[model samples]
Target: MTQRSITVLPGDGIGPSIVAAAIKILDAAGCQFQYDYADAGLSALEKYGELLPQTTLDLIAKNKVALKGPLTTPIGGGFTSINVTLRKHFNLYANLRPVVSFAGTQSRFENIDIITIRENTEGMYSGAGQTRALDNSSAEAMSIITHEGAERISEFAYQLAVKEGRKKVTIVHKANILKSTSGLFLEVAREVALRYPQIETNEMIVDAVCMNLVMYPERFDIIVTTNLFGDIISDLCAGLIGGLGMAPGANIGKEVAIFEAVHGSAPDIAGQNIANPCSVILAAIQLLEHLNMQDQAELIRAAIKKTLAQGKTITQDLSGSASTTEFTDAIIANL
Candidate 1:
């Protein structure tokens, strides 16, 4: 395979260490890629006086593929969310978060596998039309969902289901109440569902879906929903398997794709060396799959499974006492 260039964002907190572990495992898996490092989040703010510098954006555009660690976005004030900004900037329409059960974890469920396909750039979660009242008593935000956005995301979901041989695609929404926005989404998604007769389609209200997810998770295969719901549901699915430390997300657009650990920057454990690196490692697997390096992706995945199944040299999050580097070393050794 020809060497590919990938932009690497080390992010903040434990992001740097986990990202380093992921890169080492990738190399061990025999992936031929050149990495171009850039800074974002708090690290960039401290060094460049901005959360996201133009130079970083330029590098991401040039590479068209990025492996990002969890970035810290300051709450309140004038700072916009770096993750949201990147998604909208790149028009990354699909947020693919997949969680699967790994042996030797402390999770209750076993043989769990689910993927949440989130509409990345629209709806209530986009922070569009946000405003505050003069009296400081009330505030409001607008949720705008276009027919094009809904249709495309629905199409993307079914296409992925077909490709992966997934049995069903659940169209999750709350069309009963938020009729205007959610109703439009349901309408368009149902239209898309009719086009894919080979794949089973199930529609459930957002609230009910949440309850069913916890009670009967196996009934779900691929969950497709709007921005806010997807963000919440993906994390819930992660909990079923283990936790956010085991989840991986991929934001994909026509020209560019960014894979990342779908968890927050753990500033509390920034340099403890005990933070779990599986999230970023799984994210690298997604990146490899995106680049069509399936053999290498599966190789790394199998190694991770073996390491976790052995119930040894795993991180604290997975109920083991190994540090991030030790956990990484175990995976590399398995590879």
Candidate 2:
């Protein structure tokens, strides 16, 4: 088979190390692919005077697939988040995050399986607008909503539920408060849900959804929500299965898909060899599945599960003493 190429953005801080570990595991799984490196995050700013360089965008355009690591965004002000920028630029409107319980992990939940499908490029993150009073006393940020955006995301969620054989899709929203904005979303989502009659659909206010998530998580199989709600709830779901250290994310569009670890760049731990690479490794598995490489994807998945269950060699976050490299090596050995 021909070797494929994928854009690799190591991102910032411990991003590089974890990304390398993910690549090594992929290699050990007998999956061959050429990695085309690109720069982003603060590191890219230092090199190219920008967080996202044209070259990096071009690389993704050329390869049509990318595997990214945790990228830190400026806290107060500076450049926009590269992750957000890339998603909007690529029109990647669906964000897929699956949170599942694994043995030997720190999560309290057991046998939990949920897929959070977030609207990737709209709502509060729609780049709508921001305005301040002339005296700087008051300010406002915009949350834009469109029928097209809501319809597509809802369709994607229902279709995904059918494809995965999921039983239900819970639509979380704040329609009672942000009536116009979230109302439009819920309205369109219900319309889309009508098409998938076999898949049960439920709706709830965002605040109430949060409460039930912790108390009755087993009631949910799939969650489809707007950008902001999805962002917050995805992390909450992550906490149910495990921390962000074990979560992986994917931004998908009609043209391309980019997979990433949902955690942040641990600048404090950069180069310390103590970061957990499982998140990125799982993202790599998603990448393989995207490419229709099911056999290789299953191999990597089994290897990761076996490695984690053994629990002898794991990163500190998992209550083990192994360094990042050692943890990766254990996964490779399982492979």
Candidate 3:
């Protein structure tokens, strides 16, 4: 088999350790690939005087796939988000976040499986236009939504639903109040939903979706929404199973795709060896699936599920005392 090269960003705080654990697990699962390492985030800022260096960008462009750890964007600086920068640069317009229940985790629900398809490159979250009053009293930011952006993202969501054999897709929007932007999204999504008659389609307001997600999460199989709502709803779905530590996200475009742990870098626990590595490990599974290596992805996922079910070597966040390395070793042993 030919080897594929993947760009690996070890990010900041606990990112390095967790990403290393993921790499170890991928190797154990018998994935054959060459990894090209690069730096980004605070580490890159310190080393190269920039949050995202040109070398890192070039490597990502060359490799076409990246497994990134959580990056910390310095607050109150003239700095932009590294993740946003990468996504915009690559035109990664679709964000896929799936969460499922794992036994032995401190979760309130069971058998929960939901995929949140987010419009990654547009809407209010895009940071498009911003203006502040000279007297520091009023501020405004534009929420831009294009017909092309809405249509493509809607198509992507329905296509994914069909591919995954998902039963229903709930289109979440705030069309009642924000009738211009969100209304456009709802209009486009409805038009796209007509193309897929086999799959069921439901429309819900953004706020109502939140209430129903907490009340009747099982009613939702797939959720497609604008960028800002998707971001918040995905995190809420994460809470349904466990936490952000159990969530993995994929930013995908036509050419390049990047998988990452959806959680933030825990700077307080940087080298403590107690941070959970499941986020990055799950992200590696996404990476494998993206590469069309389904067998390896399933093998690793089964190992993780078995280990988590056994509940012997889970990390602190999972209400266990085992260190990150111990938990990772347990998963590898299961593999």
Q: Which candidate comes out best when scored by lDDT?
A: 1
Selected candidate, larger lDDT, 1 vs 2: 1
Across residues 1-335, which tens digit of lDDT does each residue of candidate 3 receive?
Answer: 77899999999999999999999999999897799999999999899999999999999999999999899999855677788788889999999999999998879899899999999988986764343434767667678899999999989999998899899999999999999999999999999999999989999999999999999999999899999999999999999988888999999999999999888899888889998899899999999999899999999999999999999899888889999999999999999
Off by over 4 Å in 2: 128-134
Candidate 1 per-residue lDDT, tens place, 119-168, comes to 99999867653544447686777798999999999999999999999999
Each model's lDDT comes to: 0.93, 0.90, 0.92
What is the RMSD of candidate 1?
1.1
Candidate 2 structure quality by residue, lDDT tens digits, 113-166: 989999999998875334334465765667888999999999999999988899
Error of 1 at 49 (Å): 0.7
Q: On a 0 to 1 TM-score scale, where does candidate 3 land against the true structure? A: 0.97
Q: What is the Cα-based TM-score of model 2?
A: 0.97
Q: Once superposed on the true structure, which residue ranges of model 3 sit more than 4 Å away at CA?
A: 128-134
Task: State how far residue 328 of model 2 sits from its true place (Å).
Answer: 0.6
